[model samples]
Target chain A: MSDTTILDQDRDAGFGDYFALLKPRVMSLVVFTAFVGLLVAPGAINPFVGLCAILFIAVGGGASGALNMWWDADIDAKMRRTVKRPIPAGKIEPGEALGLGIALTGFSVIMLFLATNWVAGALLAFTIFFYVVIYTMWLKRWTPQNIVIGGAAGAFPPMIGWAAVTGDIALESILMFALTFAWTPPHFWSLALFVKSDYKDADVPMLTVTHGRRVTRNHILVYTFALAAVAIGLGLTSIGGPAYMAVAVVMNLWFIKGAIDIWRRTDADSEADSHLVERKFFKFSLLYLFVHFGMLLVETSLTPFGLGGWS
Target chain B: MTQIRATHEIHGRRLSRNIGLGIVLVAFVGIVYGLTIAKVGTDPNDDLGAPWAQAQDKAAK
Candidate 1:
């Protein structure tokens, strides 16, 4: 075979390549949040049905990832962070990604409806639409607030999970959704502070690129305060307990300190340390969300033992 | 005569894809079966004490 053929063969898409189109890391967040949502809601679902609900919600989330990859392949190739995604890396055809995304969207929605209820199925469908159309196609390139609003797409899983069991929405689930929604802006803006050039080069209007890092830092600080309010407020809801309240208080304090550290620093300080505070804040944000949700799960587990929830 | 090798790079990818697809298909079948059993066993109409069915009966009356 010629050298060209050899190179082509080496680059041929594998099963893993197609799986990567689903953006598994992001899907993991979807799975976790949705699981917490289902379990914490005030209803009993069969363990198997609960598992299916989480699985289908994850699949729906992954379908949106695939669709996002398909729609954003152009700008994805421009960013160091996303350049190696399946489509941008040439491992999968755009049409293939589109087809897989559409196919999974349908299958997941229908299966979730069958296994759970129409509420969850409808929420999943709307999430796919929001991520693909509203976020990817419209807001991403057009506004600095892209992630601010686009965060809704990621925040829906818990609500969908709650709906799966209860077949309705409630304040507790809405609080869960609000916790993630409020968390997104700071979580993303912190990363954008460090990787500023990626969005600039891609011509995407990220807060860091559009408003400058100072403003981005300020936004992160403000949003972190809002997030703290949401987090603390969630602890007052039906799902909150002693454990969750403690976790919320401690994590929010730490998060606020990190945000303040980022806010107080000038570009000189950040550049001197290679954005250490920003990067640290970003890393802590991940743990922050996980601990909060994990505590909620803990509260639910303790409920049967009469230790969980406000009641 | 030129021999075609079974262990070519592209062939390996194809094989992995096939195996991955097989696992997913099997898992899907298992999930569907489990879901069916769960749905049927917990069906509100099948259980006299199910609050949901009682609520529905009350609403109908």
Candidate 2:
């Protein structure tokens, strides 16, 4: 179905093009969240082991990206936003991406099992499977709420990280997972609102393209409310402290206000401003997740010095 | 001109292939180092430390 040619390209594909298939931006989030999860747990990991766990987790996340690109090459070639991706741009073949993704997936999972524990390794494998199979192949093109269900894949990193330390999952890690899960819908929906055309042109079943902007906006607000609940609740947990609570309260307030503002705007208003508010909301959503996770890292690092995590 | 073009293409493919192989090699070494050569924490609860500490306690006895 993909029109992007695998051969006879005018120019040779470079190393960077292949690297781009790993979706470094998404991998960074996986790395950071997984690192926070590992560090904030109640035990000390060898520094090298912890670093290795994070690295493997990032690789697992990247493997998922490459597999996703391989499968979605057809839609990617059509969508304005994704047309520049390596596979879609004819820089790399679809089969090559699939092979690389599978290789990394196996490598990361097996090595993580050896370096850390089976629980973390299993979680990483499941994350890759869910993203590639459940999200990329099945739900993405078929459901308007693709991201809502697919969000679980992105939410598993911190849990995997936590498991890496304790060799088990617990309430604290689940709460961290919940934080990301609940945040996903609103973040992606806001982007979908602004870029509905891309989804429509690609024939993707994004909420905005299928249900219209009004419905998408309402869903964003609803999910934002849910996200705020999770974000604020996380602060009350043992791993979270006064510092986290402070960050959470401010960020959630601002986030909810942004969602509400988006909910009220007419499409005409959006168009007049060139989707400025929608764009700002989308950008803020990125910062929102980063700040929350960054606070967790800060709290964890400060704990040894008598300054973090619930006094 | 065709010969020159073909050689350039061969060189490009070789470069890309080598880089790909290099990445795989690096990833393999990193994983091996982390798995075999690396140590966890010094606490008894830490994975590597626990076994070694038990051994030391036995030898001391």
Candidate 3:
């Protein structure tokens, strides 16, 4: 009886648990960026197929999320931000998640191959492996440079979406990749600023944990500067236009200012939530990427009427 | 002890709940699967041979 209770204490079940494992918030970003990539490509991709590709991309992203939760169940239990995930909450067993993840992985890629070019399908397969193997299992727990390097997995969606339609990669797609890659460190470190103990307790070596808050802040500022350059540079491409450039200019300024503000502040000064400026910046950073990517969709669509590209 | 009965009841409740949760997961996968194949690759074959084949064909005149 004691042993049964012990085993049972290790589990919990709820509908929300599996949903949480999907990392819906992260999947939303993946979908938004992938959709922008699809919309902005320089050809007439079938809208239905484009929509299908986006669906599969979103599912692929969710599969990665599920696999990540399965792998990180140990540390996820310790972090308040991650403690409620399916595996950690005992809603789903790790084996079940792995099985689901693998099955979804196969379905997304194979279905995509049937619907799109093998190029796009191959890219999808690599992305799953990149996030699950390279980032989650290897880089994340092993290195402080995890987000900086592992950031590539999150960045590849736009490229994948572009490949889905074009059956090839392009400069515009790479720029889209660059936008998300450059934005990740600052986005993550800022959250780490507030949840310092979670990473520490979880024994995960987030930038803030290994390098101290000051260093992480400085790194955020640096990445923000690089991100600003990428955004503005993207504004000069064939995919760029007045709408995208306008969004880029405004968002870049705000993002850089936020990073700069964080860079100049100390941990002791930021401890009080009464100000909430850091939290505000972190939240804005989320919207910042979405709006900029969303604007690209607007810009590209507007091209038919002479509102895009150097004009 | 009375605690033993409570623990057993809790475990029973959890197993039932898990099976229920599993059913929903199955349904969700079916939906995503149906949506993926039903919607995506119908004309995606065009994207492969060349970009915008249909549009070009329409304007060939």
Candidate 4:
């Protein structure tokens, strides 16, 4: 069957199928966060250097995605959520994904080192390693806390962006990292709440599958509380201002309320409602991070006019 | 004759993919090589050492 599928795909697959293996959605997040990081840092970057840095970082992120797809193809094929992916759908060979991933990894890292400082280059390399080796290969299969620990891989892009300009990690970049890291748990767990069975089917040991919905709900509420603290704290930093603080306060309040609502519901209640609260919370989580980062970018863009940041 | 045509079609696709991959690989190597030269040549503080070392010496004084 696999051979037959591959033969069919050999005739049908196009460039798009191959590109899908790079996970462009995830790459976009990396690009935006990294760009924000670079722009908000203290020093100025040569526009050319900055563009190259973000491009290479995006490639590194795509490399990480390709490698993840390659490694997770087995379980990915089993899950409804991932069954249509390039490798799982037989649109591309697993070996091709692996090769593309490795080639891009080397190309991105080397080019980034040339384009910017080693600090950013090294961080990009480590992010890929953590995502591919730690999260995808090892943790995704081994522990329920996989997303919790593995979230670091996703959180590194802003720091890499900051390092691209500043050449060092500082309190500001660390805080930026903290914001994303804190936000990841609640964001992912909310999705897990709705799709617990997918994890169960894939045997990926997500928090929901291993701990049950009640514990997962409680975990979501707890992580949301932590995320609020980090988000609110970021507003007090130099990069933040009235604009960011206002958005942060309102969003965090809404986020916390959503978590509490989710926490109070019984699984039966959720099922009766068709997981409405969970679905809404999951969708809102996307905006939660986006607005927070968008507010930061807004504030930074206003800085040249002397109207941004705390006085 | 039909079986032979199908096999030929499969082989043609495979060959096309290989050629595409080869071109991409070559382009990637060229980009890296060009960027390395540009970066090293332009930045006195780059890893190639001599130019950057002289710049650092000038800065120290």
* TM-score on alpha carbons, each prediction: 0.91, 0.88, 0.81, 0.85
lDDT per residue for candidate 3 within A226-307, as digits (tens), equals: 9999999998998898788887898899888888888888777787654266787789988988888988888877778887
Q: How would you encode candidate 4's per-residue C-alpha lDDT over A176-252 as one tens digit per residue?
A: 99988988989998998886466677788877767888999999999999999888888898988999999999999
TM-score of chain B of each: 0.64, 0.49, 0.49, 0.60
Model 1, residue A87: C-alpha shift (Å): 1.4
A184-293 in candidate 2: lDDT tens per residue?
99998888777746777777787776788899999999999999998888888889998999989999999999999999999999999999999999999999999999
Residues B2-40, model 1: lDDT tens digits: 897668778888788899999999999999988876787
Q: Per-residue error at A62 for model 2, in Å? A: 1.4
Residue A89 lDDT, candidate 2, scale 0-100: 83
Worst 10 residues of 3 chain A by lDDT: A9-18
| Chain A TM-score across all models, in listed order | 0.95, 0.93, 0.91, 0.94
**Better model by DockQ, 2 or 3?**
2
Highest-DockQ candidate: 1
lDDT (10s digit) by residue, model 1, range A1-311: 79998887777788999999999999999999999999999989989999999999999999999999999999999988899898889888899999999999999999999998999999999999999999999888999999987898999999999999999989999989999999999999888778746678888887776678899899999999999999999999999988899889989999999999999999999999999999999999999999999999999999999999988
Candidate 4 residue-wise lDDT at B30: 74
Q: What is candidate 1's DockQ?
A: 0.54
- Runs of candidate 3 exceeding 4 Å displacement: A1-16, A272-275, B1-61
Better of 1 and 4 by DockQ: 1
Candidate with best lDDT: 1
* Model 2 residue A215 CA deviation in Å: 0.9
Q: Which residue pairs overlap in candidate 4's backbone? A: none
Which of the CAPRI classes, incorrect, acceptable, medium or high, describes model 4?
Answer: incorrect
